[model samples]
Target: MSIERIEKRQGATLVAPALLWTLVFFVLPFLAMALMSLSHLEGRSVVSGPDLRNYAKIFTEPSLLKGIAVSLEITALVTVISVALAWPLAWIIATRIPVRWRRLALLLAVLPFWTSYVVRSYSWALVLGEKGVVMNALVGLGMLSEPVQIMATRSATVIGFVHFFVMLLTLTIYSNLIQLSPNYARAAEDLGASRWQVIRLVILPLTLPGVVTGAFLTFVLCIGDYITPQILGGNNELTLPQLIMLQLGRRGDYPMASALSLVLMLIVTLAYLACARWLKMERV
Candidate 1:
């Protein structure tokens, strides 16, 4: 074989496993779920059929619609807050921190991610619950007259999300930050630009790719999360993932649940495409 043919063969060999895995795991399961969503629930069992009832049910069900809205709201709020918080921290880590401490800082950013998701969510419950640490401390210091119920609130859900997922956002942005040369900002300063101007004109624009990536990941993960909302959210804070879980686990409505899952997947997929398009535009 010629050198080009050998290289082509090696490349194909490396890609084959990944392609097989995707087909077996992701593609096959997704196809199954799509077919399952079209099934009809008959008595106690779901029967295979061509039905638009599942999709219609999702649209007409008030509770499910509310749940989706709540999930999207939480995801959007968390994405904005997490990205804003990550930007400054990433800048410090990438530009200001000593080389020796950079690794340690990165580790610190990822430390929360090392903890179990359940444990982290429960820990937030402990801190934010009525008569919990925060409430007790506030009462002790006469900051409040009564124990404030922080858990089972929308705010608490967002807080828990930030606590656990902020590190991921920071690390994502930081990776891009480190790749950016400091000379742009330095040159801006040398040209008698203010700090804000340097950031707006040079740093912020350069870091937009990372910001978009981190926000997209955070939004997708947060919106799909069942554990955090289930643990922290009260009746009013119902989320889409929780609703899906309720349908599958509590109601045993597999067809409806599969339909809901597909809807969620479609939304995330659209957002992913939008992010990809934005990234491509930025590259251009």
Candidate 2:
């Protein structure tokens, strides 16, 4: 056999395990779900048919449509807020902090990750409640005459998501910032650029990839999260994940649940495509 043939065989051997794993874990389950989505639950049993009823109902029903909108709204808000708050803190840690303490700073930045996600969500529920620490502090400080409604609202949901995803965004942005050479900023300043101009024109453009990556991650995680919204929003509104759970647990409608899961996957896939397109354009 030729040397090239031997090398090809070796390469295939290395790739075969990963391909098999993906086939078993992701592809097979997705195919099953796709098949399940086309069937309908009739009375107590699922009626197998390649039908569009689930898709039709998803688009036509007001409650289902509202769930999609709510999920998107919460995810968008979390992504934007996480990126905005994280970028400055990331920049500060990367650029302003001493090199020796930068590790400690980053560690402190991600301190919340040490706790359980469910625990954190429930903690926020209590903290944002009317009789919670935040409202009591506001009243005590004379900032509010009464405890305003915060818990069981969209605001609480956003706050909970932002708190968690901010750490993730900070790490991504900080990694990108630190990878950049300081000479870029120095050169911009020497060419008569102000500090803000250097940041706005040079630093921001270079860091766009990191910001987009982190935002995309935040979008996926926040949109799919059921615990935070279920706990913080207090069932005041439905999100896609909550709706999916309702279908599975209450209605026992596996077909509808599968369809809703596919919808969620489609949204994440579209987001990833958009990010990939933007990054390609930036490179060009």
RMSD (Å) of each candidate, 1 decimal: 2.5, 1.6
TM-score of the candidate numbered 1? 0.91
lDDT of 2 by residue, 1-284 (tens): 99999999999999999999999999999999999999999998999989989999999999999999999988998888889999999999999999999999999999989999999999898899999999999999999999999999999999999999989999999999999999999999999999999999999999998898888889989999999999998788999999999999997999999999999999999999999999899889
Clashes of each: 0, 0
Considering every candidate listed, which one attains the maximal lDDT?
2
Runs with alpha carbons beyond 4 Å of true place in candidate 1 = 1-21
For model 1 the local lDDT of residue 112 reads: 74
Name the top TM-score candidate.
2
Among all windows of ten consecutive residues in candidate 1, which has the lowest summed lDDT? 229-238
- Candidate 1, residue 73: Cα displacement in angstroms equals 0.5
Model 1 error, position 153 (Å): 1.3
TM-score of each: 0.91, 0.95
Please give the distance, in angstroms, between residue 128's alpha carbon in candidate 2 and its true position after superposition. 1.0
Instruction: Give the per-residue lDDT digits (tens) of candidate 1, residues 1-284.
Output: 99999999999999999999999999999898899999968777888987888888788888888888888889988888888887888888887899999999889878877779999899888889987899999999999999877789999999999876678888888889888887888999999999999988898999898889888989888989989988887666588888888888776988888899999999999999999999999998
